[model samples]
Target: MRKTLLTAVRDARSGLALRLIAILSIAILPLGLISSYQTSKVLEKNGALSEIALLDRTRQAAAEERALIQSAFGAVEAISAAASIFDSADIDCDAVLSRLITMEPKYIFAGFVDTRGIMTCASNKERANLSETPFFQDQFANPGGLVSVRPMDATTGGIALNVSVPVVVNDDLIGRFWISIPLTLANDLLGESSDTANLLIFDSEGEILATENFGDDRRTILPQDRSLQEIVRGQQRTFRTHNRRGDLRDFAVVSIVDDTVYVLGSWEPRNTGALTGPSERISLYFPVLMWIVGMAVAYIGTNRLVIRHIKRLRQWMRLYSVGQIDFSQARLQSAPEELEAVADAFRAMAQRLSEQERRREEDIEEKTTLLREVHHRVKNNLQLISSIMNILIRNTDSEEAKHLLRRVQDRVMALSAIHRYVYMSPKLSMVRADQLLEDIIRQLVVVGSADEPENKVSMSTRFDPVELSPDQSVPLMLLATEAAINAVKYCAAANGGKPWITLTLQDLGEDHVKLSVENSRSGLAEEQDSDTDHTGTGLGSRLIESFVSQLDGTLEINALPDRFELHVSFVLVKDEGDDAL
Candidate 1:
């Protein structure tokens, strides 16, 4: 089975389908992989860059927070130092506190303490316990020095950053000056944004000082080693982070003093992981869709414009290969430039093939029909000539007359030989003149001598490959027959015969034909020469002239003692309407 299959494939032309499949594979696979990879890379880069941009904006917000906190701390330090020079003799605490309240620093509370750490005056009097303040206690322990602390606020219940400086009299530590600044300014600095998450401020001990939520106290400070925290601790610069929700968040923390750490955190959501869902879906299916569309179009285009026309052309070619050749009209409509040119070539080929076959068939048929008619007419003419000679022979009493009748019979019989050859041949518009003449001469020798044949006479033909149509061939053949008979019968080598006949055909360089018949024979009788130009010339001579003129050809007659020669020149005019026929 395997061997049979292999043989069938070899006979059939196996590689066409495999080659198309390979072409499709080669064309499609690399593009598919490359397109998928490129699409993936594009999506990846877009998502990553968006995330980076979002983180950058959040970091900017965080940096703004650090700036706001630092500015608020500077205000608190200015107020605390200003309180140090306040009255000690008049002790007009109310007047001094009212003057300090006019400073108008945002979200700051200022107050003062007496020599014994007793609260004297307060700007936020409802919330102040100056003697118990963390800033006041720290400054009293380190006398004549400044102190700052992030402490729980008594009024708003949020943390406040407190700054303190010693009140000195004559360079002696007398009392303390203290001020409080709320941490809610961190959230205020980062303005309203929907995609921005809650901002929180945390103290150095990781206690929530301020937040976007009012009543919430949950501390959300990042670990100390987090990117945001490290950046704030190391350089007081901005940094960004990703939370558990995959939100890009940023924060800035700055230490206003040894005890005060200000923090600002801002978050914006990053969904790079979510973008893959749509991108992967498109990547998985886009190439398959392209291939399906491409092949479908290829098949349809190839079928309508290429395959069907080629099949028709192939069928026409097969018919042309055989001998039928009857195509009168063969045309195809192949569009698209290349296919149209191919169709034009096929049409031309079909026309040529049909013309060739038609000419071939016509040649065969014309030869067959013309040869049969010529042979039939020649046989009838010979029979009539023979019959007429027989009648003349009976009427005449002279030996010469009887001899002429006998010679006429020999010539008639020779003409009959040519007819027999034409009848036997498959197509015989013309005969090979040399072959016909040789056979006729041999027959003449056999009949002329009953006991012995003339063996010393030689017959040689110098004819070119001349094909004579029936009109030219018939009379010329008969003339050669008659001449050869006269040569053998009347030539002058009495006992030892050395006669010779040479027949030649030349092309004449134009559309003319020349037929030469030569024989080494002595002069013809005087009667034959007179008959050549007159109406009483023998039927053979007259018939030769008549046939030659009928074929639109000219004839020449030459006579000699050593040679009886005739050279015939004629144009081989083709029949009119032959091409159409």
Candidate 2:
């Protein structure tokens, strides 16, 4: 019972049941905490919503202010056009001013000022003066040039827009036309659905011109700092500054008429509320409750279902490891989910292993067949070379012909030597080229010098040990055989004595091999360039060139008074019969 319980605990630790419990706890805990936080801050969230809504209302109010300014400027442009006609007309200044004053109620008054800075015509008779007014003084300040617009009061002592244009003819100053329009129509632009918003317009002189409400605190805002007043004078469209109410407010201005910039500003405090603690508490509880229920379900499943099935499956797989295949009684049966599929997978795996064993046997048989065929072909090729050498021997009787046939026979024997080594060993294709060369030289001593010791040539070898594939080994063996025959025949005849032939193989760096043959012979230069018939002109030189060309090697023949040497060097590729291939 104790072992069973321990196994159950181990299964539970590795199983998904405990993992699901952990995931539920992690996923639901943070959500519960966030919901609880929101519940506690419900009132704060509402206040935040209100503040954001007010900021949007402020932006809308600024847009309306710009539209109102655009409309008022249109009216001013129209009035300026009408006043231009008076310069050529035969009319009194007083009559012209009267007609302009009655043209629109939005215009509080209209008049004209002369070159002497005197108001020549009056729409408001009481304040009508030829001089002494700021408007009259500002009008003639530019004299005969473009007149400046001023922000001032209407005749009713309310904020107003003031405009003036110089009456010029042929670049000569005549007088200035002036008009003042009431700013009451501009208040229509300031009205907003949000309660705490207000719009105001200030001029360059730090004076309020048109404002929705001129409370003492807001009116004094321009006097406290030059920033707001500068915004009015310049053409900047959007600005933000602190109002006298100590609230950070955004302001935007638009030109209603020339020189009169209308500004709209609204305030918002940063700490407007969003959510209450109580509302967040309830939101947090739902996810926490779900986590508890999920954990309970997982704990029940760990003990009742997952542990039981997994322990049985583990024992069955352990038995399957030792080649026990009776799974029908020990087979896993569990909930019809991933566990049942895993049991079926185990059965299928066992059957696949059995099928692979049979395939392995068949592969061994096929490889055996291929190895035998390779050996057979190698034997046939060696026999063919032997037959060709014999045929050439029968067709010729000259001492040179006999020597050539003997060299061909030796090369055939060299190939046969490699074939015997491969056939004797277990390996199918490769024979070490060094071992093959040593054996061929040993055999050549017996056959080429069996009759006479006076005609004997001492053979010696020097080479770095290297392996060659059969394809390379065949051509190389033929070249060596030819070089050996040349050393024996030529050097023996000329020296009037037994001579020595040395075979040396050198490895030239990573991808090349060199074969060197040198013989001790006097008058060696005369022999190589001799006009002799079969010995110099026949198959030996051609065979040497063919082997060198086939192996992509360079052959250098050096003849001295006493020594004759031949060197062949070529690229070495990996042997074709390498085991990896």
Per residue, candidate 2 scores C-alpha lDDT tens digits across 351-399 of 7875775687587657756766676677778878888877887787786
Local accuracy of candidate 1 as per-residue lDDT tens digits, 278-379? 545666568777877776766666667766776777787787677545555766664667766776777676778777777987986877687578778888
**Model 1 per-residue lDDT at 433:** 56
Point to the candidate with the largest TM-score.
Answer: 2
Top candidate by lDDT: 2
Q: What lDDT does candidate 1 reach at residue 491? A: 43
| TM-score of decoy 2 | 0.39
Off by over 4 Å in 2: 1-402, 492-498, 507-511, 528-537, 574-581
The TM-scores of all predictions, comma-separated, are 0.37, 0.39
Task: State the TM-score for model 1.
Answer: 0.37
